[model samples]
Target: MDVAARLIGSVRLPGAAALVTGAPHGAPAGRLALRRGDRLEVYGVAELFADAPRPEAAFPAPWPGWDRGVDAVAPDGSFAVFSGQRAVRAVAADGRALWEHRHGCWGPVVGHPHTGDEQEVCGGLEHGSVHVPADGRSVWAHVVDADGPEHWVVLDARDGRETARFPLEDSAASGSHQFSLPGGGTVLLCVGMGQDGVLLYGADGAGTPDGTGPSGVRDLGEDLDRILLDVHPDRPVYLTVEHSCDDLRVHAPDGTVLAGRDAAELGEDRCWDYAAGFADADTVVAVAENGEDDGPGHWLLDAHSLAVLGPVAYPHPVTGSLRALGDGTWLTHDRATDTLSRWRRAGA
Candidate 1:
């Protein structure tokens, strides 16, 4: 693939420095950008790409400890969902809490296998997340309960009421990530760490686990550093997984690897970055730190064939991974210049 990135626009944010938190996904308002320094600020895709881009809103950093550094903003930029150590809150642009739900401490108390004495433990909030589906009517929260089983709860975005819940098979999961399908009927939850697996849940109000409502679980395996990158909105049956930068595997929902390529096989100097995913239904984009120390570079692969298409040429060094916009464009952040740029096919 002979690809070139044209810098359509750029925006400098307010902060001591830029902390690129990957490419914002699941938001309708373009790509969401979160910058942290003295404080935390959230910017919508329009705010970064519009002729006159401005911050949609700003909030205090370390918002009681954001688990997994994962949060979601509504597509219209009306509200944002934030997951803290023990609670998830849907806050309006004005910083008003629309609703808040709290769970038990991330760390659960344990009793010795033989002794009855209680053992103190702590895990923090690593597997918790809050995601807003495309419809913008509901928020998907992966709440981890140290005292009991963890669950994937669907809450009304307007009122934060639990509409449905699905118990996760992996109760000791350290973190969880969610990917919403394009048309907005199903959402895939990838429970991270201990479980290292994926769960299919119905986006509708019914969150069933008895093989109903198109819900099921697939274990990727144990002791493998894997992260769920993206699920084809059009084809939820297909998804991408990044194994600790070692390789990118495109798999079925049943943990079957359809096609994959390791970084070494791609002739790269190091592992691929975690910043890779399905650019579209037919194309997958992966990035690696440039061997020449010229920042990060990307690779294009045929999604179905898993054939390497070649590298994508960027005009500037990409400090972060490439995030697909689902259209024909992708977003890249330059930390050196503190700017966010959108790129497309050379002529597209």
Candidate 2:
């Protein structure tokens, strides 16, 4: 047990509308149109002003994850979205172009069948991201080719120029899964599945296989039932929770166990069924709905160890992915609605 919560605060989206991944006004908390069905509708964040959540003046086609730009707020409040078709460009906030880069060849792993390569339809964002940071003029990106579209490349955000790139020769390293780190660097989760193996593309944009870790990937292979993958850029340990009692396991860069803990099990409340993890570089916090009645429950576990430290009651039932914004505050995204809710860890 490392730490616990004392006082907590909670808030929800005003409109009943379901949400899709849109730009989050990271600062004082503003919102944009949430994508639903075929179109986009505006939603509000925490109170931007006494009168917030106002209607967007102009609109464009809605796509999920478009605003996933690291800036928290997209330049001009718009981002490029791949709608299972072409790259649709839209704007919400004041938009600008930073540096941008695109990958050249797809590399060795194109026709590989075991890694689910065929599932990704052609002409999509196969392997590349346009990063628009806080400064509107500076954009950075990494675009890989079709053969091994998931390889990573670091480039100047303003122009689509290749600063450097790392390609995955194995079949498992696919695109569509990326983990953002604290600094400008990113960890591209390239699956080296089948014979390929799992890898982490570090800040230097190099493909480092996780299997070769000092402890070895196979050591935990059979012991693992599920792998919940999330990244905190500051922490060197890769994060995951075991299926039993949600036995927490933290692994170092070379595959050695950093920490492990088995939480005291609740009668019917078990993490093996459902648990959520949020993180930073050093720690990952997991919250589980522990009561037998299916009521909202709370528990905070050290990201490195399975140790359970704090327990609290939630205002609303907890669900979906959580984004830890430090300072005890957390952003919970509802899987069903896709809307974002901000929860402050109860303070002392």
Candidate 3:
């Protein structure tokens, strides 16, 4: 395949970075990723359905009074906003306040939890936040006087109230891989500085592990830097931007490396997976962002064999986040123009 690389378009927005998710067809759908003079400007994808650009959602609160900017957008459509000193605001998607919390891991533990819907979002809350919701209200929140082992609490959507909280068996931080699965399951790419690996938590349900009752927990032992989790019920597992010595490893539930690649140099763990990346459940599109021209660089390699499909170049560097829609194009961040860009690799 001959790879052609170029900037699809240069968006004109300034301020901070953007949290971009592509539309159904790899086109900018749900909402356009925008930067707002420093705060987040409202350019939600829901505007197309409504009038005058009212996002079915918005971060009603301004960026934390004392913070750099919103660090990330959740796989559950929530925003992982920075709130000074390791604090994060897990804003809900329904234009509601899900929860405002801080990191719990001691040193390097990825702890970002995503809001799966417009209803609830999750994260480590300060003041020891915890409350389980019932019948649309927070059942109870055990206020953590201090920031120790705060549980991942389920909350009520209406008023940032808690319902129930459970302590995390482990204290791995939320890395770039914090996301919710199709069924309210939380996935974390645990990079514990000393004892790191990948761990998954799912709502305790009928088919889940018997011991967990309603919650499902599994450990995929391996230190990972960046990973792209595909929670779409249609596509589970994940297509990752592996960050150990510049290697990409695609795995299955059984820990099988479906596809693998090694990079002489390391790339961003949190990279663009536009079109859910070149590697589908069966194919792997392993790419590096620091190429001369377009992103694909001088050669598009077979994720497993490093075989050359062709060379690809980009007008700018890919930034922010990436989404795999499974079509042919990918939702990417072009840092040069700061536009939510796309890359067509399948049939382009």
Please tell me which predicted candidate would have the highest TM-score against the true structure. 1
Worst 10 residues of 2 by lDDT: 208-217
Residue-level lDDT for 120 in candidate 2: 32
Looking at model 3, which ten-residue stretch has the lowest summed lDDT?
A: 126-135
- Candidate 1 lDDT, tens digit per residue, 1-348? 557767776666544133234324245444554645422355555556666666656654335433244677787777778766567777776667778887655554432122322222244545477787777777778886645678877777778777666776554666666776555555666665543543333344233222233234334544345577777636754545555567777765545677777778766576687676666667777777646756667777777876888888777555556676555556666666766676765665
Best by lDDT: 1
lDDT per residue as tens, model 3, 1-348: 456654333333343233444211011223433333333334543342232344333444333332222233332334423232233344544444456654432222245443433222233322221112112222122222134453444433334334334565564433222333323333333222223643333332222221223344444544334444443333445445453425555555434566665555334442333223442323344344454344343335553443446545445444344543343444555566655544555345
Error of 1 at 102 (Å): 1.7
Model 3 TM-score, all chains together: 0.54
lDDT of 2 by residue, 139-162 (tens): 333344544444443433334344
Cα error, residue 159 of model 2, in Å, equals 1.0
* TM-score pick, better of 2 and 3: 2
Segments of candidate 1 deviating more than 4 angstroms: 15-26, 29-46, 50-52, 57-69, 107-127, 146-149, 169-171, 194-225, 252-258, 268-270, 280-282, 289-296, 316-320
lDDT per model vs. reference: 0.61, 0.39, 0.38
Specify the poorest-scoring 10-residue window by lDDT in model 1. Answer: 111-120
All-Cα superposition RMSD per candidate: 5.9, 8.6, 9.1
